[model samples]
Target: MTRTRWKFARIIGIIAASILLYLLLGVKTYLYKASVFLPNAHPNEVWEYVADFSNMKYLNPTIEDFEIIEENGNYNHWQYTVQYKEHLSHWPYLPNYAKARFSIKPDESKSKFFIKSFHTTCLINDFLCLNSESEFSFTRGYSSHGVHCDEEIAYECPAIFARFCEREVKYQRDAIMLNLKRRFQ
Candidate 1:
């Protein structure tokens, strides 16, 4: 083999090895599923709390502002601008801005509330790659009602993406419950 050809082979091998190492060790683990029980508030009240888009600033800690640019009754389509700071193990904390669309629905008789949020941010960190759009839906119910929450994140790293989805959903749910508790108290 020629010297140049051997060097090219060595370089390709090194590149492949580096990619494998990144996949194995450079990926981050994000929180995927989480839930909290709010004892006193009913689903209807929770729905009302979430329905008011402008109230997001009070509910979400990381949200700098939530404006309802447009809406139509139960189905409200609006833009959400959020600012967040994250700390990695070896890197300095980084701040990020994200924008998304939100939809909310309420079933008064059944005492159930549903929320859907779609975000445009695809990548959270260097190792966490979000290849697909982000979406989350949460259902809150009263005593006899059914409560559920689901989140979907399309990414090359499902494990890490799942964790991030879980944390995001949990934060929104908890925020609604907290607002309801405060309002009634």
Candidate 2:
């Protein structure tokens, strides 16, 4: 009985230490980027849909819902919810909703527009919750081929777990952009 109890205590201690280490070492912020071009669309045409935060519902599949809480000029404060995957649907991992403030600027030539999210309440996901920023630039007049789009994400997470999920994040971004292209072209 004494030996069995000692083994159990040691196991528990190890688990506790592992958890502590993870909490300390797994926290970080990362910047990610992606870009794509729309074959037959122009930046002006795309801006109408993207400049409005609520339109993300049509562009992004993961965006279950989007509401414009407030708006002032080219700035918007919005509340949105992402579709929760099965594994992330439990306990604190499940988020009620996300909030973000975004802005849009038309270029000097009016041939392009730049949209950026200055702040967001949710980072990548609930498990890796932190502050995040996103930037998107839509440019046209490059020989009339199409509009070129570039996007960048700066995410600050308390856990590095999201690093492993980069592929999913990339796919999600691309899918949204693809949807935008389809909508415009």
Kindly list the per-residue Cα lDDT of model 2 for residues 36-106, writing each as its tens digit.
Answer: 78878877677657876567767665656556666666322332333322222123354334667667777
Please tell me which predicted candidate would have the highest lDDT against the true structure: 2
Write candidate 1's Cα lDDT for 1-185 as tens digits.
Answer: 99999999999999999887766555343434334344555555555565555666665554544444455553333334333332222222443344455566554455455565554443344333332243444355445543443344432334424455555545654665455456545
* TM-score of each prediction: 0.55, 0.69
lDDT for 10 in candidate 1 is: 99
lDDT of each: 0.49, 0.66
The residue ranges of model 2 lying beyond 4 angstroms of the native Cα positions read: 1-26, 74-96, 122-128
Give the 10-residue window scoring lowest on summed lDDT in candidate 2. 81-90
